[model samples]
Target: MEPATPLMNDETETLSRMTPVEAFLATPASNVRSETPQDPEHQYLWRCFPDHVWSQRVRDTSSWVWDFGYDIQNLNGSRRWVCKRCIQNKSPRPRSFAEKGIQNANAHLFKGHGIWAPAEATKSAAQRKAEKMKTKDQRSIADVMKLDTRLPREQEIANSLVKSFDRKHFQRLLLEWIIEENHSFSICEQGRLRQIFEYLNPLVKITDASITRKTIRHRILSAYESHKGKVIAALKQSSGLIHVSFDGWKSGNRHSLYGIACFFRDENSQPRKLVLGVPELRTRHFGHNIAAEILDVLDAYGIQDRIGYFTLDNTESNNKAMEVIGGELGFVGSTRRGRCFGHTLNLSAKALLFGHNVEAFEEQRSDQLTYLLRSIQRSEFEMSSDPRIKARKPLDLIIDNDTRWLSQLYMIRRALTLRPFVEQLVLKHRQQWEQDNRSRRTGNLRKSAKEPQICLEENQLTTNDWDVLDHLARLLGFYEDAVKTLEGDGQQRRRKRGWVGSYGNVWEVIQGFEFLLEVLEDYKKLASEIPDAEHFRININLGWEKLNKYYSRLDETPIYYTALALHPAFRWGYFENEWKDNAEWVTKAKQMVREVWEREYRHLQIVRNSVADEPVAKRQRKYYNPFQAYCERTRTVSGCIVVGGWGQ
Candidate 1:
């Protein structure tokens, strides 16, 4: 490409060539004055050259001119010049010196920057020698490996390195590092990390000592105190009657009686179970005194006024206690007292078997059966490994002292079911006992010597004991009859098949047995005419009457009646056996009950509604303002108010 011409020869030359006297008229139409050339070609060339070629040339010359004071330009159709003085003053432009300084200063930072370094003789002899010395001073990977290989010889070094770190301290350090690096950790993440550290670190043990427990307890107390304000606020917002269920039970040691009060909302939409009170009952206190102490607990929880009913197991002391409380609270009749269903069932069972000679027999048979079974168990254990005898412990062995009688009954029933096994056990024990007696007489010690000595005395199996066993068998048969009766009596097969009828049978069986006991007591004289003879039965008719009266009264109670009506075991028969027999009477009774309940409920509602509306109605008076009423109630005498002004 041909060299381009200069747009301007020089600043001085261009200025001198211009006519100074001519008016310098600058207009948007033309960039030049009238005296200067305004050719379209020249104007276009000037604009293009300045934007493209002239701008590039100026940029290229700027660094050398500004820094080194040297400038050079092309010499062709365009006039250009170079400054020799500027070039000479630049001192060889310092290319080699600047490069060497930068490389040396950045050596540590840039050593690994390049993909590869030149292997040519670019370095001076002194630089090469210095580099060699630096490499010699530094340890190589092979040298370090050799040094590590010598570590086994230093016992002290190994001991120092093996010193165990305190896990908690290390964990703290790690947490601090994490916090320092990340600024903050979320509560959940912090807890997770804490658990992880606790699991992994041996030295950071979780202390559950008494001191820790006390500390936790104190913290909980503090939290509860903090929440007390909120709890009170919630209580104020809630409306309705609060019902409380209070129960007291003696602890295993009987040293203290603990009372638990559960609060709940009643059918009238009231909150309950808000407070639980526990008080220690002294052993010296009477039943009435214990009841008073319970009242004291109620007072402490601010629950005395809210209590509507008290449910308890059937105990004389409890009933007396309830009587005392009722008198104090002015609650008449049975309004404040209710009996537990579980306790009533037990009482019913006791009542049904009243005046029975079966109880003594049951006790005797139970004792005999226990004695026999335990002897067999001991013998079985001793001869368990004997090759000739396949010894096994009876599944129905009675071990618990408290339930021994029940266990005896269970074992007898089981023996009846597994007749072969029981027969085997009995025969085995009998044979072992015979062998033991023979050995004892002969003065021969046997491996099964730990076995209990069986009593062959005939007096041990008395008439009373046999009578009890026979009665128990009869009771079982009665139970089966009761079940069959229920199954056959119901209107529908499905309904008849339920447990309700059986419960009725259970009640009937108990009453029938009591009646039988009465008959047995009356027929003592006739026992002489019977095949078997025994001791004359003592007249315990008074005891039976008392027992029968106690149970009958219990059955008459409203709570027992309610339970009998509601119990799943009696639901089918309750409407049929009890209510259906007297349907007309029941219908009248139900109508009367409904009328009483409706009247009572309506009266309660009226009272409540009256209480709610009184304040509202009073406030509706012309001069009465609710704000003023509030102020009056709060006893605030002065506040901003408008008087005698309708607009205000």
Candidate 2:
């Protein structure tokens, strides 16, 4: 290959010595050898390189002719030798075409980018169109006074409407027409007219649907009451014994009032509840007035001399009322007064033991016990595995302090059952008290003089306090006897070294038992001396027996044992049922009583098994062996089992 000639141009010579296209083609890939031109004004320069020869055309080609021997003049004038290989290898130059012009470019960009614009523009355009469509006429006829011109005519129309629908006159005319024609009228039809007139007429306010129904019913009832003679004639055909139970108490607001509930045994011997009466007795004068009001009510019900019994709480006013009625009515033989046993027991217990002082003492004790029990229960819950405080629920330890003396008895019973846990709590309490006392003493060592007395008054027992304690003691005694009576024959069989019956407790049982015995003796004396009034006097001996059975039966269950111990009526019902059967004037009465007693005795045995430990069981076995031996020793006595042969 010949030495390559460098291609040059005016701009290329001034700047980096090569034009951009020339530098690109001349580097290595373009192989140019010589220059030629196919057009008159242009020339092609061919330069040979290692890979290929690139050709470029030059414009001026007149004077200089090199020894390569090509005719420059001939090549310059539209006839030239071209590097056909270079021309074939080179890519075609891109044509300079007009893109979008500046304004067109911007418009095209804006249109392509406007995705949200159509939605926004359409919304705004629609709003503007709607605003334009809502134009109103400012000088319309509505602006003129149509109301002022038509007021008198409208008033006349309203007056005509009201006159045409005169409700009161219409009702009266309808009633007269019905009476004259002897025709029945439907309330549903007639009542709708009243409703419509009330709704439309401006002067009348419509009654609510509920109020309208109530008023119509009241009117109908009033019409029926005008014919009261018919009601009395019907009542006379169905007469039976009337039962009245009355109770009186002072309310929380300090109002002394009496509540009377009347019931009656119908001809079928079934009890029916009647009207309950509440008469306001303002003064002593009103007492008689109250009585008269009660009598009037009874008479209205057509009750004459068929009253069986009047049950009332033991109140002086109630007794006086009974006396007044019996004397005035000349039906003294028909009226019988009986005191309610439940109310009497409640009142008697409250009057004796559950007075203010005793109650306050109980409250204090209960609070302290509750705090201690809760603390122990919490500790037990935390130490899940601790056997000493084994996770007993706090409710199981909670003492019910609402009742009079019963709650205390319940607490005592619980203490006996949970003696180990309770003992721990008592010890903890003693330690806390001792620590407090020691702290007080330590404080005293720092002071030179003794503390001054806060007041001159020394605490003295009030009569009320003494009375309360006495009453509580009496009730405690009753409970003690009840416990003893229940364990009568069973005690010897079940007695162990440390075991205590309900009456053998350290606090209340010993003294209470002695007191109960004395009370029983007094009751026996009273019953014998006043045989006529024996039924009137309260018999607590029977009450004790009933309570014992209840508590003994309760021993079988963990939850109710303490409750049964405290409640004196658990087995009272059973005893009463048995007693009633025994007293019945029937051939099978004795057999019935025996059956009840046997069932109850079996239940008691079950409870005893549940409560008794090994020692108790051993003692029970030993004691019962003799009874069994005695039974075997003799034949039956008087058609009953002979134990030690009591029957002659």
Candidate 3:
């Protein structure tokens, strides 16, 4: 049977003359040809005539069905119109609106979507006006047109959707708002909040249950699964090597979570950073245990063999982890390990603050902090009469985070600024202590009324201590700026000196080490001349030693020199100018970089085809090299040759 002819000229002309079955109009013939080639952005708007049979894709203006749905064939592989609103809002979503008729689509839209056709809306217009007259915002269409500034086309589409409430879209926006603002999980569970939502839409829970904590959690997890799949697929498609940066952190609940984040050039050649996983660490955090955890994640993503570099905090155990991974994965551990630049600077900062055994000093300070801070806040030992102490700055003290250098700087700086208040606090505590002793000796103090006197001896900041801290904060500021430059946050000014790309890569490490070393050396030499600063000469020397140790360790990896040499911005010229005085160091750096080049790139001499020239394939059959894997993943090798003594 043929599709019913379109009644475009007058849809209602035959309404009075035709039967109810014949009232449905046919899908447009031009649409049959036009809809096959879909717009990339609007691919959901399809008109399918599968098997050359009409599935009743009616385009009747009188029936407002198409406004709230999409052609299901293109949307989700169903050859029918499906309600998009229902799918977004409903927990157990309806698949399609209708396959052979408009009546089902009409019923679903009106019931599930709370949408009314123009004819039905017209019938209830008087009743709707009586129930609630259009408030202060309503005006005549003529008056609205006089003030309307939108283009005619924009105005038409806006007016059509102005009354149409998309419950799913609203719910999604609300969920995002709640999550972004860190709102409580039971925000939507309140009785009043649910009532407000019911009055606002009247269809918030029509197709699904109320949005409870369970619903929110489920939705968030579902989104996580969806995004995880996309990230895995993107990683697979990425031709570049995947570099991973991971660290272990503890939550408030004391749960140890090892967070693994990956960085790689995506399929579009865009740099992408994403957290791959945060697996719980139940076992003791040993080098071998950390390696096993990282290996599990890499194996799950199937990128274990493609590992490029591991950037981790500088620690004995972490270094051991690199060795373990290298032995198992067949790579040079020394060349692949990248000491986190921030942690390198932080070690120097720690050396400057705490002379030696930084951990021991910091741990003891932490234990004393509880009682020390409480004594400072006591009413009888209140610091000063000056309002500035209480009004300006935060009332609490700043504690240093062992991993972050800036925290130590902030702690020292805050202590220096609040010195006067601290002095007054010491005086108050001393007076209170003397009074308590007198009362105890005279037998005038009641046993029930007595309380232990708080002490502030260990916590007092001295004049000499302030002088040392003042200098410490100033010097640590230089390291803070270097950290910013390495993290790519210094891009707003002139292009970062050591950085080459959008985000800082391996190329920035060497130059950053040089800049920070210069600052430390300059300060170390001046420590002898400065008054009250002689006490910290030992601190400045300790910082210098710690920083120089890492600078010297740069030799263990050939990548540092290689990345610096290959950068398009400078190449070997940067090292030539910077290391003009150190000719020996320059020569050694050049030799290391050249070895990598000859071993990887320059060894493969391409020949079009002498019978069949494919050195990459030939090498794969004979033995394995990491260069061969890169060539296979990122480039096609049609011809190649390898000569003896390539590196030599």
Question: lDDT scores for all predictions?
Answer: 0.39, 0.39, 0.62
- Candidate 3, residues 1-648, lDDT tens digits: the string is 234345454434424433221222111122222333434212322222222232334455344465445554433433566565543333234446444565677665544433444433332334344235424334433243343526787566445544464655766887897899978767867889877875564444332224555456556766876787778788899865898888998876577889998888877556778788877776788988988888878877888877888888887888888888888888877778888888888888888778788767643243344444445555423465776544443345677776555688888777776566566655765565557656555756544544333344555556667776777888887777667656653122323242135466677687777766776788877787777676588888888889889989888888898887666554666676677799788779878877777765576667553453633332223213322222233221322121242112
Please tell me which predicted candidate would have the highest TM-score against the true structure: 3
Using lDDT, give the best candidate's number.
3
Error of 2 at 279 (Å): 3.3
Model 2 segments beyond 4 Å from truth? Answer: 1-239, 284-293, 296-300, 333-335, 346-369, 381-392, 396-426, 434-648
Record all residue pairs in model 3 with backbone atoms less than 3 Å apart, i.e. clashing: none
Cα deviation at 466, candidate 3, in Å, is 2.1
Candidate 1 residue-wise lDDT at 175: 46
- Number of the candidate with higher lDDT, 1 or 3: 3
Better of 2 and 3 by TM-score: 3
Residue 623 C-alpha lDDT in model 1: 16
When 1 and 3 are scored with TM-score, the better candidate is 3
Q: Look at candidate 1 and give me any clashing residue pairs.
A: 263-272, 263-273, 264-272, 264-273, 265-270, 265-272, 352-510, 500-569
User: By TM-score, is 1 or 2 better?
Assistant: 1
Candidate 3 Cα misplacement greater than 4 A, ranges:
1-221, 236-239, 362-395, 433-437, 440-460, 489-502, 532-534, 568-570, 573-582, 603-648
425 Cα displacement, candidate 1 (Å): 4.5
